[model samples]
Target: MDDKSATFVVEGEGCEEDVLKWYYHGRSGRPNKNSGELSSKVKKYLSIKGWVFRYALKNGKKELQYQSPHGEVYNSLRMACKSYIDQGLGEGRMGNVDPKQPKKRKCLSIENQPLLKSVQSESPERRNKLKKQENRVVKTSKRVREGPVSSRNPRTVLSLLIDNNVVPMLGNVYYRNKTGPPLMKGRITRDGIQCHCCSKVFTLTAFEDHAGSTNHRPAANIILDDGTGRSLSDCQRQVSDSMKSTTTTLRTRSVVEIPKTVKAANSIRDENDGVCSACCGGGDLICCDYCPSSFHMKCIGLKEVPDGDWFCPYCCCGICGIGYVRDRSFRSCHQCELKFHGDCLNSKKPSEMKTEKNTLLLCSQNCERIFYGLQKLTGKPILVGNNLTWTLLTPDHRAHGGHGMKSSAKKENQCKLRAALEVMHECFEPSESVETGRDLIEDVIFGQVSKLKRLNFRGFYTVILEENGDLVSVATLRVYDNKVAEMPLVATRFKHRRRGMCRVLVDELEKNLVKLGVEKLVLPAVSTTLETWTNNFGFSCIPDDERSKLVQYSLLEFQGTITCQKLLK
Candidate 1:
């Protein structure tokens, strides 16, 4: 790195506005990792500093207002953040504090350079081909050094937190009434948690109130999602536990994990499994970083141990196509079985991708399509029949709870889920469910359905029907590869059958199924209803020889049942 370096190359003497632009926009380094991700970064930084961004109507137009740690307000987000950054740097200067550096970068560094100097410098400092990194690092020390972040240093914590992923929901959002996390119910924005239960986004500086209001039960069964899956006593506890312990858990960058890995390496040995999953042999095998599965280098076609961390086929991040991550918690889509790291997520909103549509690409657009698409369909009602109505009930419905109408919303879902389960029980015996261990079908409806994998029950939705607001028909559906869908169970209450309620449910399902790229719908029809399915629904009986085409699916079948299929496309 020299004085003639390109990063600080100023072609022309930039005016005061340029200085301010660089001050707010320059680091493009710390907060605001990418062009559109600025709001996310700034939101997190301001949040940690007790500043909240709010909407205000000015001149009949909505504008964001930045409220300070105290009651003071700033109309400009950049200016307020700048003042705070300068204040942090000033405090660091007064105490002679040295912020922690995790690694030594070969690129040039910012040192002895203050923010004020960048703004105030008007000399002939201009150079050609100015190289400005988005997130440029400011050197507090003349030389790069690696050390632990000081717990007493607040600014050090700020930088560390800024570099890591600052997602709205720290943990997976859960609905107690729903079996799994809902796709559309609880939304996470960059700045606030869009709670599904209360249907409100609490983004004020007094975010403490959010935790407080949710702590107590609003209704007998309606428990508001506090954004956190677990219950803390109050909002203050939520803050201290979430952000205060920032020193230890989220302390350093990826470089800091090296020592921990090296220390663990000392005790590394062949896993207790003793045999390679790939070879069924043990000698000279490398273990997966994320799981007990081990493989011979040649078995997986790896030349040797070539990386910082080696994730097996199942443990890798889907986006970055890499193994190591700053944040250890890896997320996976139960549908696609691909893994993801929080840090690797582009976190691009739908609108952001619209403007940069040609440039930005995601790992799998279909997964996103299904995610957002299903999210949109969760509570939407589809009028499919002359006198009946159809609606898709995802875990999202359980999340919304009818906008805080006490336990009624939750109780209604429970009743519907129970009703659907009853309709299935009426048609399928315990034997029909493929050995329920002598337990009643309804008893195990809500239990973990993993064992029913052959049916692909993991990713599914309940499409139900109503005749004048009363539950009349139900079906459990799952789509795979968007090429095939299976409705394992469907039934209309004996009395509701004359009203074409089941027809409405199937019609609504097929409409959405076609939209999701599904071509065929498969289902198991019991002996008694085989004619009804084959003759009325235009479903052809699947011959035993051709049934193997659906082998990839775990289609639920009764002991005495005929497999049937209907082509949608």
Candidate 2:
């Protein structure tokens, strides 16, 4: 080629062979290839290394030309192939090449001169940005070279232990003192301080004074390095001895006598009057069921009269001393409804009981078993379903055994109840009235009736059906005083409805109500089902004017527009 059109070339004739060898080595274990395949492979390899190959005229001869994006051209494939391989090997792309034939060190070549000059011709703004980036890299490297600095102040107890090089045991007690080693070892206790060495209990001040006394000796030998030749344990002991002597001198000078005014104030506070026990005077007082003393509701923190008789803390026998007034934590005896602390049931602390307010806390376990036995005698299954069983549950059952079901079983039952209620209200009740009825079931039937006494409302009796231990249906019956009762929530699973399940539940409930001397049954029926209820159950809708007649029976507060009553002769 003429000098004017000649392109740079590597000083080798087997340039194509060298490129093929490198390509095959990189993609080893691939199928063998012919001349055409070698040409195609080399083109692909060069393209990946950011070099493009094209057939172009050089000095009137058509030859393959290779060019980089940075504007360097080569007519000889050998030089272009060498440049691509060098860049790949330097960037770690050519893996595990023969180390014996080490790669030549990269140097600024004549072909790279154009790229360097182009970079140097950049605008001042761009150059300044590049310089700023280089400075940031240097700052970052310096930061990495320097190690982290720690704070002098210890923020937590764990940090303090770490700083002192003290390995703490689970039950080890750490003490802070003004003198000596600053921290002395002791034992943790429920009531007060206990000395680790002597195993004696003492108040906080007494323990501090005793621990720093000259007679005090190390409870256990601890190896410590305090940067001194002296034994750390011996040095610590000497410091305590010096502090004890100094403390004795200070204590003698600070001693003072009790003032007469302070003594007189204490005496007046301790003196008791022979009137109402809590406030020394009575306005409206509630007499304790077990004690002669009476306490004003306000004095004892009682907002309202208890549903059952009240017992003074002194008279109440239990681990929880005289139960606080208005404290719902106090459980009641299932049989008597008399308040007692849960701990009193088994002489266990509140934490150990693991029983809820609804859990039956009987006077004794025997009473609990008897209550269950009574339920077995009186209660019966009312609704049956496919692979399902139903049983009646009363508040008395909950008071004795906590929900009359296991936690998992209770959750399953609640889910079934919620599902059944949702379906029944949607199907039977008006759209607007559905929410009201649901609220009644949620707030009254399921929520409060079983746990709290509202007005003359007695308690809730639930008939729940289970299929293979999963709840499927539930019907809630609310009993009221004056021989009256109301059925608020009666529902069966959608799959089990119209199968006489609800009918069986109501029939069994009616039989039980008769046994309990219930003379009348009040049912809140939807407008759509009023006629069916009236015809099938012999219920007659009470006129709006007659709603006042139900005030005494508490039926006047019913939310449904149609209040039906069935007289049970």
Candidate 3:
């Protein structure tokens, strides 16, 4: 056989070496020895036809693999090259095939020579049309390889299907046999679907997936659309028009009789006299004695009608008379404006009254306690009777008769007095001067107690004895020649603070000083508590010049001290 006949026979058997030799010799008119050069040329031609050649290792041997864009891979390079040449020739891409090229006469006949020549000599317009046809074929092949193109948004598609009353299948519906029932019936949703035959609800994905098992069509899909010549667009337009008409009608309608409705309400209210002022006309109402207002007896917790008179809280005048009145006869609190009936006061409750002689009435226990507490904190008189007294003792006086005591009782009293005095000194004295003044006061008290039968220094003192015979507080009232009295010491036991003990002591001392013709009271002031004396007790701070003017009146020469004084008046 000739070279062309040998090539044709080798090509039929699909040999890579013979195919490469045929392709190279057909194009260059010379047999190519380099397999690499021949393979490169073949690859270039295949690429132009949208075929790709990839090199890979298979079973320890280097192999050339070919794939189409549609992902069809050829197992052999010879087969891929033969397929590519056959496709190119069938599409007239190799129409210019040389007539001199040798081929098997049976395959390349004279009848096919004219057709090939005509294709090679085709016009530009015909070639352009052919190119367009090839492009369309490529695109169609791509579409076939991929699935259908879904251009619409999923949500929009789903809504459209729902509005059209069409239940689109979510996925493929499977079956055990052609007539068998499906295992899974439907999809789950917030609101499930209802069955028509049994009048029950059933949610589903596809009718075919569940119809055989349930044997019932979905209620929503019972009405079949037999194409009455109406499309989904027509139904959508109808729904939109109805919605527009509803919104327009709502916008055009006017509010009805708003003013007349309000007027009717007011007239009904006037007919009822706007209800009771206190009870809103909910229960039995009584008119106020001093005003047009009325209140319910049940609302105020009143049991019976007042025998004398009745006044509402608004009608009462001033703080003394103002408060809810349950009875005909009531008394106002001396400390506050609240008034309560005489029967409301309980003897068991704490009273503001300092002594049994005090007759002031208080409305409640809280107000009474607060009143007494304020009096105690401010050092005012807390008692009214003459139960407490002031006595003066001299260093030379003897402990005998009514005032005399046994040595043991006297020693105990001295110790108690010393303890009380030390507590007072610590509270009133500055940190630096506490020890200095403490020793002096101790020496005076101890020296007198040790040397004499009775405290005999000619100094005035006031001591408050509790009901239990314990000293609650004490003070030294020093009377001067200039009609001024100085309170050198005033101290209460720590446990007795805020109990009016100090207040009683101060009151008794002042009364005695007034009897002695003392016109003013002077006392050393602490920087921290100076405001208590000035604001609560009406004492005023004396300036340096004014302090000197009163120096001759003060018996105790206070050095470098801030002093406050109060007039006896």
Candidate 4:
């Protein structure tokens, strides 16, 4: 090997001084394989300090060889170089490594002298370009200032509960006052101030009682006005365009509203006006036999409907897409072709009619049939195969009653079940998996009907699945309250398959529902369990497609109705 000139370029000034001192003091002998040019003093100092060299050795071929010492020298060197550059000393006559070498003009090495630049003003072109770039950056970030929100809320009795201690309870105002001048029953917010009875500005820190007050139950209407503007027009346009066909169509309909005026004494409510077409009884509310659209009596603006009258304006006689008149002065619906007199329709109070003009009222069932028919046609079986366990983070000790606790458990279980299903599919063939099971239909049945009943709205006893001692499967029932109890979710562990545990769980749930005042038992069965639901459990299977539309539960009303003659005894 030929003797070569050894060079070193320090990163920062501090590192430079240390390196120079170490080099000069470490080397004492003529450089050799055993004892290199490192001075004895520096070598001894390093040895005493227990430090070693960490570097990457590169040969003529530039292949890297790893070597480690007490510290990572390369990493330290890079960090020191970054510090030097950050201090803006590179342009001054301070320590700086310039890899670009002049002359041989070859790719230079960092193991050489440092280079610096003199501080001269930038040229006009460069200065102008920098200014333009700065301006462009600033302009891109410009934002329009938003104005404050307008305040114009109405006042009602509920406001009193905010500042005063008033626990709002159902029928609180109705039963308490019973016959006061209809007290204003809303929240107020014209100025920042609000009324005690109606304003909703209850402070979070309020120590006053906020429950059990007559102010809480004042009847207040929640009017959701889609203000007449371009936005409403745009929404209407979107909905209209999204409809299945451009042609106007009448559909099966039911009256969903009950007049709130039943308590007013001497209000001789007409007998024919309140009767339900479906059952002939004077039901305060009525649900459609087809879809999920509800209507109040007043909402239809019905001045009168004669005896035996059935069918709302929306119901098609299945004829000219409108309701038809039944024999003996019965107003029949144009859609669905069901005939009845006006009283059978069970119309709402005239004040509740708020649907936008030009808007068509169709039941949820018809809507689904028209729009999602294809999706339903193509729907397949659920890919099931997984062990799922759900731990309720909500402590079950609180006793929300069995209904609430069981409901929460079921909901959480369903989520966990879904996750487990996805995981199982991921582990197997996901593409071939299908969801032809009860879970999906259960979601719809419980979701749509329960919510309707909860709003103090008019609904009927349909199907209910109640969990029993965590062991029920499937059972029979007649009528079920949509409002009571919660939905139960089915879970499957690896060892629990094929033994009909699901069936057992469902049976238990259904029986328990009956025990807990459930009037009906309902379940959506696939080809696998369709016969089982009907034959074994005594449940009537709602035809598959419409299962998604109408409430699906067999009515097991054993005490048959008898409109016996009031004979002249």
Candidate 5:
């Protein structure tokens, strides 16, 4: 019977009777309404007692709702276990299997092998049917080959596909969407593998692989008219543009010329005792551009041409900076404002000149301005370019935020830019020395006056003005880290004073500090010189109480003022 019919029949039967019923209210054929209710109560009581039911009330509303059959079985087992536990009953050695453990399927024995084989074997009819299916596949493939083919050969088919709308071209072979300008064509192609537009070679696979080469597509598209497809006028225009771009001369492109070393030695040698031929009056000989004569510019009408480039009287020196000269050869002392022959200046030939923008031709001393200028402009902590050294002087802003300057009343404060001397004094030698060179004077120098004597030594630079040329002031700085950098020592010669050399020195040092990501500068000085921080320079001071004990003694006593400025440039 169907499930619905079964449910109706089950519902018609009242629950089996239990002993000691109180009511006989219903007719004899009919079940007492309380009978079903009583049975439900008994079942609930059995549940509390943990007794399992052999059968469920199938026709009950609860039973009609669907639930997992496995869950129902597990519930019945759980109830049985609980009832046994409550009753203190034991079913010893029952071999109750673990519900979680699956039953293993039995394996076939050797005796059953032949029977299994007979069952697996296919009949002859089944084999014949399989053969017929394979034959059908072969026939279908044969019919496909018998179909008509296109008129074009394989190579021609591919070409037409590329030419017509059959297939697409990739990369530099064609322009992008026919927009922009065309690429150059007729580029020297060594073989079919080489690209005519970009002058690059590729394998056949590479060409086929990328399909759209950036190098060739633009050129191809230019040849093929936009939207019109390969128009003759478009091809002509593309060819013209390609020729123009390739042919135009680049400004910095190389030009054929003799090497500098070969030309300088041979061409400038004078036949007449290495004397200049152009400017006849000569003590030391300098070469001329047009001829091979070596004559001194001083002996001739052009004694000292400031910032000028000239050919030697020998006509060997070129108007351009390019030229060759002998060892110990002197073109002219640019700072000296006079031409000095190699023999006279006792100088070695300078390094070959290379042209670049912002290039300075001055000796180390003369280039000080350039170095400091660049430092200020770029905000770089240290300016080290073209053999010049620059460092910036910095004040500590952290410790000296808002303090006023205080100086001793007894001493007249000399506002002479002398701290650069203080720097040089400490940088090179100890604070106490017999005497400092006049060239060491800070704040008043231009170029190197000590000649090239100390070129091998590396040090901070100071320039001094001299009667002959410019003086060179050199010193070293001691570096220390105290939150920010501290410049403990710097030295300059006495003669170089008043040229703003100290400011330049300070500028260079500060540049170094800032470069290291140091924002504060610390230095020690006497309280009497507090105005140097307040009036001359800007730096704020912190109270002694606020300073770290480690550096409190080292901190300067000067009143501080905070000055806003770019330290490195």
Candidate 6:
């Protein structure tokens, strides 16, 4: 039998009795404003009690709708689980779930049942089917004050059912057929509630003060249309209008981008560096219609200027799946290889969580957590073979009480920092003086220096390669959103030279860099070692034009060094 028929049979015992009771009186059946929320404990308890169907709200995402394992969605856990059992999709296990990123929730007091902000779901046709069956089961309990509720946004809208008409109810008050019972009688459903009225359905445009001037159906529910001419009648206003409306709005639609364009006279702006993303050179450049990236006519192979707006190959917004059209702003994440509009990100995430949005290395909380996870692995030895060990260090490692470090561990980290400082000073002395050179090393390592100098080393990481637990080589590095990285200093203990220790150190650093999405590694190769770098190392000299673009990085440079780069991917 169909689910509707089975539900109405009143089987008088066991599971069927439980389902009937819930259908008649549970939180979802006769909702009093819980915003379709179910407590986590209740969900788990239902699952432990052998309710096979389940739904989960995933974290660190802006996507709509909580979905079950079999891809079904519903308003509550008990109802969803029961539906799955009825449909026979097989049972599911609550295996491993990633910890949810903490977020502040806004709530409303009900004077009855308090409600959190609604979880997203669609009013599937199953709801309508159940509602129709429910009209037969509980005719007296099915009726409620019907109208176009202004305060409640609903998932399913009430519209004329004949010929698939989409226009909705127009007025604030509604009535059922007085003769007896209307045919397409609305009722409570397994998913949500539904209600209907006798007349005044419309196929024209606008809501509230709007006249039916056009046959336009708005993409949003803002404009409810009215085909019937009766705007004024003796309809009494319902007091339920002041209460929170249980109505669902349209099935969730993608956040739309209506690009705020510059005036026609001032279409393209020079806000980004006037250079090609391909060659990183300045010239007569073609700007992306959406983002700040520009490409030169030759570099992009455009023989003629396009007649309309042009977006770069990288103009797609990861959040919306929409490519840049005209005047839209977009930024790409180095880690996820995803592009997002600044406004789209702002709409989903809280404004206080600025680190992920501001940094290219991470575009979401999941990525932010990943980077921190990688950081935690630092200051710990990673073994390579029996003899070699790789260790990473940051300012936090050497800082007192860092991430709640004990005093002894803090002292140990300080000792290691000082030892690495001695080795750096031994290998690369300053052109000016020994003390000045040592000061630069100490400042970069400990972050006790000029703000501008510290900015270059904002996220400074020290890579060390140890042979049999002896520090052999070290490199000082910084990465910017996986776009590019700069290693200002590379040094090997004099005794450890010619043993390929520096190469091993570099290889290890590159492996981690790839994981972090660093695309290229640029080094300021001192003239004495330039040939060795270009030949022994896999680096090529950066052209003068390309070198100019590197100015934005504010990379550290010395008088005798020529810049060299090695692509990571």
TM per candidate? 0.37, 0.30, 0.27, 0.20, 0.19, 0.37
Runs off by more than 4 Å, candidate 5: 1-482, 549-569
lDDT for 504 in candidate 6 is 84
Task: Score candidate 1 by TM-score against the native.
Answer: 0.37
lDDT for position 220 in model 5: 31
Estimate the TM-score for candidate 6. 0.37
Q: Which tens-of-lDDT digit does each residue in 1-569 have in candidate 6?
A: 11221111111112222332333345335663432333333344334444433222345322222245555556554566456435532333212211121111111111111112221241443221111111111010001111111111111122111112222232322222224432222222211123344232321111211322232221122211233422111110011121113211111111122223412212223343233444433334556555555555555455645645565545666556467663266665433335677777664451222232243335765445435555666777777655677888766532221343544344334444655765665554422211112245555666443222212244566777765435667788766555677887787765556788888888888887787667889987655577988899899999876775554354655433578999996
Sort by lDDT, top down from the best: 1, 6, 2, 3, 5, 4
lDDT of each: 0.46, 0.44, 0.39, 0.26, 0.29, 0.45
Q: Give candidate 2's error at residue 151 in angstroms.
A: 65
* lDDT (C-alpha) at residue 508 in model 5: 53
Tens-place lDDT per residue, model 2, 151-268, is 1221222222223344222234534433556355565332234566777754333455666644232222222223332322333334334545775676455334435554452231
Show where candidate 4 strays beyond 4 Å.
1-479, 482-495, 534-569
116: Cα error in model 5, Å: 99
Give the residue spans of candidate 3 off by over 4 A. 1-416, 425-438, 444-462, 465-467, 553-560
Clashes of each: 10, 4, 8, 77, 91, 8
For model 4, state the Cα shift of residue 43 in Å.
82
lDDT-superior candidate, 1 or 4: 1
Q: For residues 1-569, what per-residue lDDT tens digits would candidate 5 score against the true structure?
A: 12442111112121111111211122123556666665554344334333344333454533322112233332332243333322322323213222222111111111100101121244543322111111111000000011111111111111222343422444223323334443333221212123565556442323323335453232233333234465222333343344346534321231224356534432323322132222112233433333333333333444433232344322222122233343224354222122344343334333222223222223323223333332243212233433233422211110011121122100101111122333333222221100111232231211112221111111222221111111123333322221333332233333334555556656655654455444455543334334655457554454433333212112111112111222232
Whose TM-score is higher: candidate 3's or candidate 5's? Answer: 3
- lDDT of each residue in 1-569, candidate 4, tens digit only: 12232322222112222323333233332344432332333233333333333333334322221112324333242233333333432234233323221001011111111112221364543322111101111010101111111111111122222222222222122112235442222222211122247544331111012323433211121111223222112322233333313222211111123233422311222211222222212222333323322333333343332233244433433223234443344442211123343454434111111222322222223322322221221112111222211121111221121113343233332322233332222122221101111122222222222221111111111121112111112211122222222221222322223566555445444443443343433432333334654565465543433322222111111011211100010
- For candidate 3, the TM-score is 0.27
Deviation from native of the Cα of residue 332 in model 2, angstroms: 14
486 in model 5: Cα distance from truth in Å?
A: 1.3
